[model samples]
Target: MANTPLIQTQGLTRNYPGVVALDHVDMDVKAGEVHVLFGENGAGKSTLISLLAGANTPSEGSILVEGKPVSFNSVSDAQAAGIFTVFQEFSLIPTMTVAENMFLGREPGIGPFTNHAEMRRKARALIDQLGFDVPVTAPVAQLSRAQQQMVEIAKAFHGTPKVLILDEPTASLTDREVDHLFKTILKLREQGVAIIYISHRIHEFERIADRVTVLRDGAYVGTTAMDDTDEATLVEMMAGRAIKDIYPEIPHNPAEVLLEIDRLTSRGVRGATLAARRGEVLGMAGLVGSGKSRIFRAVMGLQPTRGGTVTWKGSDITNAPTRDVIGAGIYYLSPDRKSEGLDLAKSSWQNLNIDLMMGREARGAMIRPRALRTTAAGILETVELRESYRPKAVAQLSGGNQQKVLFAKSFGHDADLYIFDEPTVGVDMGTRAALYRLISDIAAAGKAVIVISSDLPEVLNLSHRVLVMAEGRVTAELTGDDRTEDNVLRNFFNETGETV
Candidate 1:
């Protein structure tokens, strides 16, 4: 008899009102293998996972576990069948302790009575086993994002799941934390656990994936052994077209400095001074907690500056409120799109119209709904965002599509300077190309742009000049011959004797 697959889906499909999220998709996961799912946002990766995890009922298809058909009407049903998923959006209760959050619904207890000490003991043991330093009794809200992610991982492993699904698990993790996660995943594979991994970071496939599956436009494109496929092939499969260049050329004729920061000091930034000019892209690079984001936050007036001077177009706006900063033709895009950037519950058109409607032009005016819809349609078209998704809640769109909406909102205003923090964090290659072109277009039009990213190649390729930050300070500023990854890393680590 042939070896039975751990989990299998036959002719699976899902459909929204006007969109086929998934279509006749067939997939299989084998025990002791890392099966990776690669696709552009909206290609149905999340939809398929939702069906398998019992979060959604498929329109048509069947799922089998170990060659036996099964139905999962709820998340608990999937868990009972030894399937667990750590979704991108965490499910932990922030106010609860780590131990309580881990064993949330099912606690160690006598009938109708909970055992707090036993829960803490088990949670602590799990954390230790995973090499994570998180207090079991501490509130989840007080922990950093990385620590909370560790808690999510620990929760997924609660019942020794037969099949584990991890979706963008390492997006917020540091390099060291990522290593720990990979080690744990390998151990799970050794224990014959079938793992379905989903991520947009292409660099991770070679490190962990055994077999690769590509999805495009809600259909299965193909599957290949990881070693047999190259990045170019994978990109083509995911995008359904060739993407020659991921980053556009940097602009050369930069105008006079439009924004200046002198001796800026904030909660997480210290004495950081930088200048951004029209027609220029100033890239900021640093590891997490190195204070890169703090600098941007201070500039956007989201954080108060202890001491500094912020001058824009010869006007001093130090420690100004966010509304005033935005009113003065400065736009800031936060990295956390779900909370800080876009309102998830609202439709795409509503979110896209926010900045425009807030402007002085729309003040005290009765903007027609038809006009708003027309304008939103035009903006979405310019960004290559699908018109079909324009009326849907932004939360229903894929990560890339939601990001496109955020981009549209930023451009909706007539801003002079644009600051984007990790704008392409969860976007795919195709959407990334579109975003790069948009940024380049903004610079070519003589508007200043600042790109703060953790992706080294992204900063190096897109920035006209690069700034390296370490411990709340700008260590090195590079342009021309001095701009390279090695130099950036050296400056990031505070290595001495490197030209700044």
Candidate 2:
């Protein structure tokens, strides 16, 4: 990697209506180096990248490209200046084919008409060059999230970009897909492409990063070489405090069974069978599309159950209405919080008190805003969310705070079973620590907690007993010595969903 900088910022700052999203911070990206940005969810990492990509303008300071200060008014201007960013959210049009989306604005043509044949030919060649298993003719809506991620990456290479920004590129990918992405990043680095990478997965930094810049609370912390920093030091730098242990030690004591799924089948799920006890944290591990989440969605009536029986405390509640399931005291947190778990437009306190506000006892009664906030503060405090954030819209809070508010919802109305699906999907380690503590507390209080996660360590360290799901069925139930990684992951490939 060259010492000369391809892109650098001089006191870059961004301000929102009532917040300084990114304080004046200076950073640089040199040619042929993978510079990783590390921070908590609200630490201004996304804000800085957005300003650099020209999706938003800075409230102060300037951005320098090749040591020349350049003003970018739009993403087009940034792209024209050899900068490209693939944000975490997919930007492709759903109805368009992969080939069409790859060359959306700059379509190949003969005279004034588009040359569809030539466009597909180049698209196919590019996908094959990247070694991604994607069909160029398939519509973007029809492809899985991983395949769509591949399309987003391939689209960025349409022009020879001097600076490529990737935000959580591997969050939705399988292990094999992540390997392919790592290889692609290395190849790009060898070709002199300066890359700015953002991810919460600490394990990936050692394999891909040349240097790391740590940010906290929207301010600059420091930058250091990957070789010089270990995981403990890096986490401390990102968190601004040394965390002795991220997971809490809680003893598991069994109680009566709270949930039982007998031959449960739903969309993307096979005949799944499982049982949850009141005083245990049951971990579910699987790759994406492994049908771990579908089984519960079926029990909740979010999806139709073809043939199965959902027994809650020995009562047959199969295909029960969602409201009735909630009435029976089951809280299910959706993986996609923005669309399903929360009403982003509402204030934090309002969302936190939604279940109580709509409960039968309070249906026709008047609600006092001040009293509601006062009541909400007690619940929010348990999850470590501040009081000042209670009145603001949930959309304005950081991702960690938003997730805390979602977790607090379960506290508003007590439940017998708490089903957290992908509980810590996007938060940093600090927020994850808080959430894990809450889980340990809930389980200690004798509530059934089912944690479904793709992260292996999360399942391994947290669960008292882990149930491995493959192709939508309970393939293996591991306890004690059987919870080793080799034993658990080996069953993921079991096509029959039965222990060999």
Candidate 3:
């Protein structure tokens, strides 16, 4: 339980074919400290983590365990050395049960025969110990994102790791689930475990982090005690420049209604009512499973509506095909960017031209690569995505850059209404600023914009009016004097879950 270095890296470096992902970075974690790897996406935090976790070998420099040099050739080696990592992108197999996955590749038993009964009992005990109510026999694919994350954390505890690495542990969690996770972190710290935590949400640091290391563009900036630094200072280090503002002031000039939903009910949503007007930003706030996203998804034909009427500029378009909805000038950018927003295997530029590729704007014209490339480059420039990255596959880019590509894709369709759901979920502060400014610009340009987000500050700051949903319904609507945090949160758990 001594406050000594459990793991240390001296001049660690990692290189891909064309870029130095990590360049001579030095970092360390003490036996019981919650050390944060603070950085924007692509700032080399992941690279450094991959090296420490033994997922990727370092090109140069050395790792020291208890003051002795060692090389980790594989993830098994790192685990053997008492390091366990839960990556941001999940690696859980879809078909496996939670208990089976927890003991995967190392089931308990002698040689070949596995002890199934013991595995189930141990998995249940571990879940109970972690304070997560997950069914051990449930298939991981059937679980929600937050539950899956809990399972990942449970896997780390099963082996009693000396060092634990968590990447964006609360990105998809509800406020209640996040509270549980924080409690778990506090418990682990008391057990003298060294934790390397990564998150874009800086507010969580004040509560848990002992020390923080900042990385900017693949180089180490500095490390400081959490008590000695502020969020602004950390942001400056991560961006390598002073960011005076995070959210831009948006203009609101409400005009005619562009879209309206009357008594909308989908799979998880019920009796939701809302409207989008031109020249304004409509913000929706809710806990997970609250039906905020489902309301919009139903409008786009992705979710079937059991009862509702969607009117587009005075035309009934309820249950319309997604193509017809898009054709009607309503562009919906899904929150799941990897699956619904972009083609990961395609180049950034190609992903940006979904409108043209699907004939939303092509309109039987001959496909011109040069023209598309020129247009895409211009749009990507506005979002601050570098020109060099245009030719690279989006899957190869960092989370922040991939989000920029997804945002840039909306420019292709000159839509009357734009729906951006969790637009800045996993991005850095710099990228978030750019996207916030862009959202403001879209509202100023006389287009109706709807922003659905879990970040309460984002919803309160950007929207002229806010709608709060809980348990498949809209519980409250706030405007002007009613938009304070107290009012919003008070309605988040109203018993009725009915229309305001």
Clash statistics: count for each candidate:
0, 0, 0
Q: Write the per-residue lDDT of candidate 1 for residues 92-181, one digit (tens) a residue.
A: 999999999999998999778999999999999988888788999999999988788889989998777999999999987887778888
Candidate 3: residue pairs that collide: none
Tens digit per residue, CA lDDT, model 2, 432-475: 99999999999999999999988787888789999988887888
lDDT of 3 by residue, 364-421 (tens): 4666788877777788899999988889999988898999998888888778899999
lDDT of 3: 0.88
Candidate 2 Cα errors over 4 Å, as ranges: 15-20, 59-62, 89-100, 127-150, 358-374, 480-482, 495-500
Worst ten in a row by lDDT for model 1: 491-500
TM-score of 3: 0.92
- Model 3 spans > 4 angstroms off: 110-112, 138-147, 241-243, 359-370, 496-498
